[model samples]
Structure formats: C-alpha cells, structure tokens
Target: MDERRNRMDDARFDEEIAAEVLPLNRDLTLPENEKPRTGREEEAHIHERKQDYAGIGKVTGIAAVILAALSLFILPVFFGGAAVVLGFIARRLGARSLGNWAIGLGAVSIIISLIFAPFF
Candidate 1:
C-alpha cells in the first residue's frame, strides 16, 4: 500500500512540474519586419539623452545661482538651503562649474545673512 501511495504522489508532482514548464513552440525571436538599431543611431540616442541632462543641469545651476543671490537679501536660510540642494543636483547632472559657483554663493549668502541678522 505504501509503495502504491508513493507512486501516486510522484506522478502528481510530475504533472505539476509539467504544467509549470513553458511551451517549447512559443516564438522568441523578433518579427522579421523590424531591424535592430545601428551603432550610429544608438550613439545619437545616447548623445541626445546627454544633451537633455546637460540642459537640465544648466537650468538648475542657473536657478541655484539665482536663489543664492536672493538669499543675500531675504529669507536667507530658505533660499540658501534651496540653492545648495539645487547646486548639488546640478553637479550630479554635469554642470560642475556652475554648481560650484552656486554652492559657494549660497554659503556666502547664508553666512552673511546670519552675521547681519541681529542688525536687521
């Protein structure tokens, strides 16, 4: 009886495994009408992506600088903090020089504002 039960269990397990397996006849290849992208096309796509990032970086860097300048006049903590954050983001996106300038200006604005806070 034990031997018969063991055979039945093994058969059920095999059936479960077979049901889970993918069919061999399914098509895995791409359609013949579509061709793979050429190297130049790929490069152009990558270049375009880089340009987009650079543009974004430039914009962010400019905004950061503006915020830093604003910090010198009003709401120094808020504007300076925003400038610093945007500067770091711009740096990560490839505007190194602008990001550096933004960071420096932000820091200076914050410090100057704090120092003069008592007088105002």
Candidate 2:
C-alpha cells in the first residue's frame, strides 16, 4: 500500500511539473515585421525622452548666480534672498556646482551689505 501511494504522489508531481513547463516551451519570438531593439537603440530611445523639468535647472542656476552678483550692488537683502532660494532650487534639480556658487555668493553679498548698511 505504501508503494502504491508513493507511485500516485509521483504521478501527481509529474503532472504539475508538466503543466508548469509546457507554457514556457511556447514560441517567444516577435512577429515577422518587428525587430528586436539593440542596446544602443534602447539607450538612444531613453535619451530622447523629454524630462519634466527639461533645462530649467541650468536656467535657474544661471539666474541664481546673476542674482547673487547683482545683490552685491543694490537691494542686497532682497536679491541675496532670491539668489539663495534659486540656488536651492538649482541644487534640487541637479546643478550642484552652480548652486553652490550661487549660495556662496548670495551669503557673501548679504553679509557685506549688512556690514555697510549702517554707514550708508
């Protein structure tokens, strides 16, 4: 009886294995009209896709630097604050070097302005 039961279990396991394996054996090729993508083609496809922010990051970074420079001359507090905000925005958008420069320049402008404000 034990031998018979083992044979039954083996038969069930075989059926289960066959069921799982049959689907995987089907044809996986694309249709005659379609061609597979090469590595470079896939990369180019991804590169050509438009990003949400596009070139806004670099623009913000440039604007931040300009604001920081202008802050050194007039409306130091206002322009410096704007420059710092734009710098942070640029950093968040992937302009690390420009953002850092803008931040530094803005801080220096604000400090200098404050120091000279009492006299002028």
Candidate 3:
C-alpha cells in the first residue's frame, strides 16, 4: 500500500514540475541575439536609409546655380528659369540653404539678362 501511495505522489510531483517548467524551457531554447525583428523596427531602418538620400536636392541646386552663372543674354533667361525650378524642388525636398542659393542666383541671372537685353 505504501509503495502504491509513493508511486502516486511521484507521478503528481512530476506533473507539477512539467507544468511549471515547460514555458521556461521553451523560452530558454532560443538564443538572445537571434530574436526576430518586428515590423516597426524594419520600418525605422528603411526610414534611416531614406534620410541618407534626402540631400540629393542639394546637387540639383548646385547644378542649376552653375548653369545660371555660365549663361548670358537669352540663355540666362532659360538657365535662370531652370535654376528657379530646381530651387523650388530642392526646397520641397528639405535642402533649405541650397535651394535659397539657387533661387538667389537664378534671380540675379534673370536681372542681369534683363539689364543687358537691349545691348545684346
């Protein structure tokens, strides 16, 4: 009778141990460094990459300024127009200083062309 009681107690204890330990054991099975990334984390990484390329407008603005400087007479009008457009785009894309410079240069080119239009 004692033997049968001891067997029953052992079985109950084994069941309790398994019930308490199964979840913890499962958690321990995975390595800390191998945890899966969530969707939000992936989106943040992509956003950082996008920011890295956001300064492309600065290049456009610089090119527009160069064109404006190289142009004279009728060409200055066209180059200045191009510079203004590029400046607007650059401003929209967050290149504040470059956009402002482009706009200023384009305006100066247009004024110069107008000032010397009768001569040319």
> Which of the numbered candidates is closest to the native, going by highest TM-score?
1
Please provide TM-scores, in order, for all candidate models, with all chains considered together. 0.59, 0.56, 0.52
Candidate 3 backbone collisions, by pair: none
- C-alpha lDDT of candidate 3 relative to the true structure: 0.72
Output the TM-score of candidate 2.
Answer: 0.56
- The digit string of per-residue lDDT tens for model 1 on 1-120 reads 998788865624343334234333223344566456799988998888888899899999999999988988889889998999999999988899889988998998888888888997
Q: lDDT per residue, candidate 3, 32-84, as tens digits?
A: 55455599987997788668757686676677667656654448888888888
Candidate 1 weakest lDDT stretch, 10 residues? 19-28
Work out how many backbone clashes candidate 1 has: 0
Q: What would the per-residue lDDT of candidate 2 be over residues 12-41, giving only the tens digit for each residue? A: 444334544224322434556656679998
Worst 10 residues of 3 by lDDT: 19-28
Residue 10, candidate 1: Cα error in Å is: 21
Candidate models: Cα lDDT each: 0.82, 0.81, 0.72
Winner of 1 and 3 under lDDT = 1
Deviation in angstroms for 55 in model 2? 1.7
Estimate the overall C-alpha local distance difference test score of candidate 1. Answer: 0.82
Candidate 2: lDDT over CA atoms? 0.81
**Residue 72 lDDT (model 1):** 80
